[model samples]
Target chain A: MSLTKEQCFDQLLRSHDVKPEGKSAGWLEQIRVEALASAGALNFPSAKQDDWRFTDLSSLFQHAFYPVDSIASVKLADIEKFLIPDAIRLVFIDGCYAAGLSDLKRAGSGVTVTSLAERLGDLRVEENFGRHAPYKQDAFVALNTNFFEDGAWVHVSGEIAAPIHILHVATCRDAPSAIYPRCLVVIEPFSRATVVEDYAGLNDGIYFSNAVTEVVMKDHAQLQHVRVQREEKNAFHVGHGSVKLGTGSVYAATSLAFGARVSRHTLHVIQNGEGAEMHLDGLALIAGRQIADTHTLIDHAAPRGRSVQLHKCIADGAAHAIFSGKIIVHVGAVGTDSVQSSRNLLLSDKAHIDTQPQLEIFNDDVSCKHGAAIGQIDLDALFFLKSRGLTEERARNLLTHAFAAEIIAKIPVLSLVESLGRTILDRISGVRT
Target chain B: MINKESRILLEVKNLKAEVAGVEILKGVDLTIRAGEVHAIMGINGSGKSTFSKVLAGHPDYTVTGGSATFEGRDLFALAAEERARAGLFLAFQYPVEIPGVSNSALLRLAYNTLQLDRGLEELDPLEFDDLVQEKIKVVEMNPSFLGRSVNEGFSGGEKKRNEILQMAVLEPKLAILDETDSGLDIDALRIVAKGVNSLLSSDNAVVMVTHYQRLLNYIVPDYVHVMDGGRIVRTGGKELALELEARGYDWLRAAA
Candidate 1:
């Protein structure tokens, strides 16, 4: 018999014991209980649901994934290729902090970087742990909240000289397992920093990674957050990220999705103060039977705020890509300016893309625009390239790489751009690098 | 300046082609030889562009009948890039705009591929940069254009100049310029024509597909063929362009 959703939920609940520690144990235990209750009340999203219509999760629910409590065997040398030499690294193996593999001393003064499991007693952790990501609405968020063991915690008071790299490495043993990776970032006023969250797996297996990340940008703070998901081909990954911007704060985010059998990302941003600026960009390059979905929401509550979003998808083989973006301007939010565009390139006839761009405005003074385009590589462009001595396949690959470079160029970190470019090219060319 | 001693470069006999199951090139017979320039002129819908595309092996056009040979080798047997590597170049009427690909990179790739085909030394980036800079002077192009994407957001005249720049870099044995003077001011047309004239040599041949006789005034074609209903109806010397300009293509169509 197939495992029922309720049975799966019960199994998850019984798999791990709650071992709360430090001064914030009571608060943490209360949060976990409330999240579990929420999870119990809400069922897994069905295909009938409008938000889950295109992406079916029946296959994901059939897998009996246990919570990985013990540390799985992983070599630091194997993950050394993904490390940035100039940045501080925080390594997580199967949702638990790997202190032996991390470089904690690289953080300079005015910055605090540590694992959330170790700093449970910190007051800041209690204040901002579940503030942005509401668990009641999303079952995945609730599951992550109820089951997350440890994640990276970063606090920046002033401009940090180097970026912070958080690596989530998933390794499976004999049985299929699940990992809930959580991250919390708080940037104080008048500071600037860049954080990169990279998720990768060592082997191919049927696993689940439910992740939640929350970021808080104080007044006049500037932050660039980058998330890269390159998991095993048979794994399932669902992530939710929320960001809150203060007065005059600047927040920019870019997410690159390249792996997994089925991957979905939800990003929410709220401009809480006046004159805040937000920029969101994403790219998904998937082939084979994989599916990648990206959903984003930006709320402009303050006046004179500006936001720009550009999302692109390149799907080949029988792959599918979905992008839905919503921008809301409150009644009092006048003089708001926003632009959203989603462009997709389908390399094969079997590939598919669905794009929905929405804008809700209560004020007439706002300037908002949205557009979506789905097309194959232009035949004329391909012919033009071929006439210049390039093979048809090489020309198509070049155009596909160019389509993705538009979003990859928006990355703020200069060093990351080249490597990301190479990775995207390799993905398009079917190279194993 | 036709020399009998020169070798035949391309020979097309009774070529017929169609696009979307509609016949466009009924029968286009033409002969091009080294050390000569041929201009194919006709009214709109006269299959001028289709004939050029057919010779370059465009996927949209299917050659229904007849054959074309270049240097005694079957031209129809080769793919588009293979045709290009075999020293056949076509300057498009409407150059495609490919965003995010630098013009210099495209040019260098074409140059290196042709160099490899010809067993010549391929230039590296540093060497190719100097060579491209020297070639840009052929069309009086700005050096900054090399940094921009291939024809993305380029002006009409700039796109034409870039095409000539490619031709200059590749140095093809046979080049067909389709309506190169379509959307150009007099100064831009003169610059483009001058670039083509400078690239011409006794070992190479040029075929100009044009609507106006103004371009012929600069390049000075050795043979001008007027095409109508997909066939070359009239063949004459350079003065035929002057007469055709004086009395438009309607006169030739009516005479044919």
Candidate 2:
């Protein structure tokens, strides 16, 4: 029998086997139950909604998704190509922690990195878990909050030299299923670290991955975060990331979306104390029948807050890319300075992009500016390269790569930057003339 | 410097072209030979730049009539890159800025492409770096300029120097400098002229399209042609440039 939307959601909710085991597990269990109740009350965002106006979720609801029942056996060699050198690796297979493939030996001093399942009862995990991401109205976040089996929990109390890499590998083999992967990163006062959250698919399978990540930065803490989503070509991914900054803290984030048939990511960052700085950079390079949507909101609630954002999208074939950025300087946010820019490149006649940058300032002593530009390959630049003995195709690809390098160069990780550059070059090499 | 036995590098015959359906080059004819440097000087509205662009096969200009041949081969039969591979180059007055593409990368690619055309092995990055380091000395450029984006945020003189740098690497047989000396100061102009003069040999030729004779003062031309109303009204020895510089282009326009 064909299932309805509510029936599918109910089955997904019932598939999770929640069992409170140890000290403070009851508190965690209570939070999960309340999230479950919220998930039951909320509905999936549809095309008629304001926030989801450009992204259509009707196709995501067509497939009946159940929770992963067993952990697929993944070998280290199977994931060897995805490993980053000199990084503390945490591997998860189908939303379940895979200890055999992870490297936790190099996690330097004053840092705690483990599976969320292991630290559920700890005071540090309990204090920030389910605290930052708003799940009351968002169905995806609520679903993740209620059903996530395990996740990566990183706590930094002092400086960490080695970067933390959370690798989430999806292998949906048995049936059409859903995986909820969550992460909570807490950087204590006066500490600094770098984190890389990466998601990849093992095969071309139809599945769903709903992810939620919450980051908390105390006073004077600095962090560099990079999120890369490279799912299979026939998968669906919805991710929500929330960040809260304290006084004198600095946060820089670069999000790269390159895969999946349909994907959307929402990032919300708020400066809750004075003199906090934030830099957000995003790039979506997709071709074929892909849709990548990004929505961001930066809220400056305190005085002397500063933020800068640059989002770029390069679409080829029949792909569609959407970017919506909103910056708000609340009342009494004096000396707030913000800049936002959106640049899009359409490589084919059928490719399309929609970019909207909005700013709301409530104070007189603030400087805010935003601009968006959508264009094709610069003909003059192409001619310049061609006049130097490069073929038209090579010139076009070179110009396209140059367009994307502006954002990829901002990534703090050298290895990631090199790999992303190679990927973009390879992707654009096959661009249809 | 003319040699009677010199092979013809480029020959133009009453070439006519237009942009946006407006005629810019009306019955323009010029001939360049190996071991020679020719300069075409004219007033602001004369078709000096248009004639050079038309010869380089710019897409915006339509070749309505006449013909151009390079080394006895039809120049119009090849694409822009093909013409470049055939040892033809144009030094743009305003070089376009290409952000995110490193200067070394573009130069190396252009160099390797020519190497392959000549049936030679391509150089690796290390080897290419060594070669480019040697070539940058021709333009007196800093080594750091090779690592920056192509022409992005470069000073006007620096952009011109970069053009000469490319010319040095490619070693084209026929190079048409279209107002390359317009934005250059005296010092930069001397440096650029020195680079071009060093590259000239008995086997290749140069065509300089300019409005002033200041550049010719350094890279002394073998012949100077006065263009007026989209045509070369007068051709003379190098002394013609001196006469036009002393007496403005009005006398040439009136004579035409």
Candidate 3:
């Protein structure tokens, strides 16, 4: 019989020889051991589970992928194209920090940006790392905690003049490998920052990129986080992110997923203090036989907290997209206002979309609303555009681009918005009619 | 007026069409010539709207047995966009609303496309803005409407007026106004009728489909056809519209 996922993971972990050392090694070792034990006890969710009903991860475990212990040889020049100009950049390749490609000098006094592996001795790292995103129940998160070699750690004390860009490039050589990328961002009280987590792959190979990000926002802190995933079509990507908001803190996040054969993103947010606000926006575009799934949860634990979310998916060819968003308002979270909307556009008869937007409120004074819709292109609108002398192809492309622009426009970075807009347009135009 | 010497802009012979396998237009035959305004007056379900839709190559309607030629070219052989590029414009009865696309963009695109089709110079956005400003006066439209989305949240009068503005911009060889007067107030009707009058020329033709003779009051028709039971039973001069209005379509149906 084939080995279970836990057995495979245990075997893979035993084969790696690197061990934590130095002054901060004790806590790191404890975290690693606890994560491994939790991962070993929990089973991988199958298709029979309600949350995994629409997604099948059987094919993902079929291949034997070991931890990438050392940095793979990747040229900085090759990854220069993925860098955002005029921004503080942290570049990581194969789950290891690439100092030659990063702009470490640009990080001034108000901002602190470094690899988490290098800052293991920092007291703040011990306080915030793995605190927001618990991995006891999630196999993917637990695996990332046990195997993450290096990732970006950003701490903002005051205000960051420019956005910080973290670029994760995956390059596989010789064997099908797996890399765990971790990110921890902490915004101190009365501070503000914008962070972009961008993932891109170089070559076409079988690789697994399991990533986790934890964000902690103090009182009155403002943070805008954007995650962009554009991996190779042959890669597998599973990412988890968690955010905790303090009193009067504001957190806004936008996630865009465009590539990978099978990808999933799970995001969780909690308003821990009164009057904290959260805004979440996401978009996924997939074609061919690709599958893209997104699951999000927002919990309002304090009074007068507000949250708004909008998620959209565009599926063409035989691709499938799944979205599940839930908002929970606890009994004491009075006057909480939460809204969630999910929209999907199917471009072909074979394309499929499953969306569920749910709201669970235990407070009588809370206002919560949720909406979900799945539809094809509007025929009336199509005919209207065609009758205006545009070719049917151009008309369809224009409408499809407009549908995606609703989310792309919400991004604060102008250059990133323009680049993502062009990418989405090109993909929509390339979809076969 | 229309005469035997005038150039024939559109010729329809035994045109039979249906929508969703239900026959709507049964053997409709009408000929329109240049420098003339023809009005097809009929009650509801008299196949007047179907004839216009079929002529414009709407995909929902299938031409089972018919022949429609526009300036010696087979109209049924082209797609909806091709028919539009060929200078056949249809002012829909109920104009569709596209939420995100701006009105100015749609207008300029249609204008530039027709210009390219006719080997004319295309205007840039600034130049097109000036031209659109000049044409909007025909319907007394506010310049702000051009900046908004195409017909999105527009009132009935505004949508009809927008349709006429499009016709003015495209400058088609043959324009079909399908029930363009149905949902308009008296003021909007007069404005729309006057816009159609100003755009008329000896090189092009207009076919106005209506159920009332009020629209023909401001823009008189050269030829009027009374339709009933999916066929035109009577054809006469502009006076036929007045007679149908005064004595209703039942008289014509009984006579046929």
Residues B102-202 of candidate 3 have per-residue lDDT tens digits of 89988998899878877999999999999999999998999999988889899999999999999998888899999999999999999999999999998
Can you list the residue pairs that collide in candidate 1?
A: none
**lDDT tens string, model 1, A1-433?**
3677667666666655533332347788899888888877775777787777888566677777877757776777978767777888899998888888888677888899889988888899999998789898788898889889899999999898787999998886567788889999999999999999988888898788889999999999999999999888988899999999999999999999998889999999999989999999999999999999999999999998999999999999999999989999998999999999999999999999999899999999999999999999999998988888888988899999999998888877777788888988888999856
**Model 3 chain A: worst 10 consecutive residues (lDDT sum):** A15-24
Q: Which prediction has the highest DockQ against the true structure?
A: 2
Q: Give the runs in model 1 whose Cα sits over 4 Å from its true position.
A: A1-6, A17-24, A104-106, B119-122
Worst 10 residues of 1 chain B by lDDT: B247-256
Q: lDDT per residue, candidate 1, B1-256, as tens digits?
A: 5887899999999999999999999888998899899999999899999999999889999999999999888999999999999889999999999898999988998898888888899999999999999999999999999999999999999999999999999999999999999999999999999999999999999999999899998999999999999999999999999999998888888887
Q: Score chain A of model 1 by TM-score against the reference chain A.
A: 0.96
Q: Number of backbone collisions per candidate, in order? A: 0, 0, 0
| Docking model 3 quality class | medium
TM-score of each: 0.96, 0.96, 0.92
| Residue runs of model 2 more than 4 Å from their true location after superposition | A1-24, A431-433
Residues A235-338 of candidate 2: C-alpha lDDT, one tens digit per residue? 88999999999999999999999888899999999999899999999999999989999999999999999999999999999999999999999999999999
